[model samples]
Target: MPAQPIHTNRLILIPFTLKITKTLMAGDIGILQKLGLQLTPYWPDQEAIDTFPKIIHNLEKVTEPTGFESYMVVHRNSMSVIGDAGFKGLPNDDGEVDIGYAIITQAQKNGYGLEVAKGLASWAFKQPSVKAITARCLLDNKPSARVLEKLGMQQVSTDVELIRWKMMNPAHEQDTIDC
Candidate 1:
């Protein structure tokens, strides 16, 4: 399947391509560490640089596949990889897509997450067949919920501690949320 592109006023959402340079890999590690995400169960911290070759090899397989395209959310002004944002898994006929994102810890609370999400989700809506975009956030994550709201997504349901927000028309919204 062909990957699609997403663009926003501040971001350029390109398709996921895994080419882990020594520098980028190192930056990934540092960014993860600063975000406190290294402690997350989904991905563990790399204890050594030697382990990156194997890690990158495995990442190559995970990154390049249908329904899973990651984008390095670069800041238009700074031109830095502040974080990663993407859609993972298959969205159903409901026009829903599972949105995922993680910004470097230092970048949080600066409104960058909401900024990138608006761009990415808007881009996703412009896809050939996309009708809506959905995102799940831990119920305790008020910031994420706010970001969803900023993108004009409304809460439709919940699972465990997760709250689901869906946006039906990102391309047409004038002002997304009260925030």
Candidate 2:
């Protein structure tokens, strides 16, 4: 099936295409115009760029016919790419998958991350065989943790540098999330 772009009230989440990924690598971010996104100069941050190869590889290696892949978060009204999000890969045998997302520092705290997570997580839960979604954030990233909390995710674990959160599919788990 063709990639079915996920949509929200103000954002569109679509997978990162190879062509655009190449453009991003070349630092010609203007190419996002193809997606109607006018991203801020702060985009293509070092971390996102550094991880592009692995993300591209994950996109190429998806086992399911239809499931999650990293997505560029495009703001509908401003037509700017605000961030990247979506599941990290296919669901495991136990029906769990990890999620990764980020918004520009300039756009942080404006709720784009929450909206993207809400849309992507709901979409993932609706897909075949998905039972839960997990996320991790640096200990200092309170805003990111709040996005998870608002998404009905509960703190499941923590380590020296990061905290882990997870939300089981309400259809399958007895526990409820506040979202």
Candidate 3:
């Protein structure tokens, strides 16, 4: 059942749907354009992340990478694509990968981010080849750090704008215990 797909109570982590391309890009210059507009008013606004073209471009990059996989975080009840989350850098000799996620502005504050994060990490651990998952957040982004902590990542370092965290696969419990 590995790679069967992961789900949280409020969201579903599944393969990106082609239909999302239109739904996300409609009514604006592009999807990132719409997302940027939608997120512009929030505190510490991530207008940079909302660039529709970049988001779409990154989504395609994730899909085409032979070493990793990505999923669109769909809100099941609303039947809407609220964000993206995925593991990157897989298949590298390093046995490590970076996990990333960005939930739409309106979706913040609720527990969905933490829930989906944990779900995705758990799913990643289930993969036989995955040894560890990592994530980093801007030092000021307490919310993102909180989600990483909820998923059992230990803070490994901090530098200027970034805080790095790592979660080792459960199979590697002995190493963690020994440390």
Task: Name the best candidate (by lDDT).
Answer: 2
Runs in model 3 with CA error above 4 Å?
1-4, 17-67, 175-179
Per-residue error (Å), model 3, residue 64: 6.2
Q: RMSD (Cα, Å) of candidate 2? A: 3.5
Can you rank all candidates by TM-score, best first? 2, 3, 1
Query: How much lDDT does each candidate structure score?
Result: 0.61, 0.80, 0.66
Give the 10-residue window scoring lowest on summed lDDT in candidate 1.
39-48
Q: Which pairs clash inside model 2?
A: 38-80
Candidate 1 on 1-179: residue-level lDDT in tens?
54555666676554444443344455554554442322332221232233445434534655453434556555566555566667764456655677877666656788878877877676666665566788899999888888888878889999888998777755434334532
Query: Which ranges in model 2 have alpha carbons more than 4 Å from their true place?
Result: 63-67, 174-179
Better of 1 and 3 by lDDT: 3
Candidate with the larger lDDT of 1 and 2: 2
What clash pairs does model 1 have?
Answer: none
RMSD of 3: 5.8
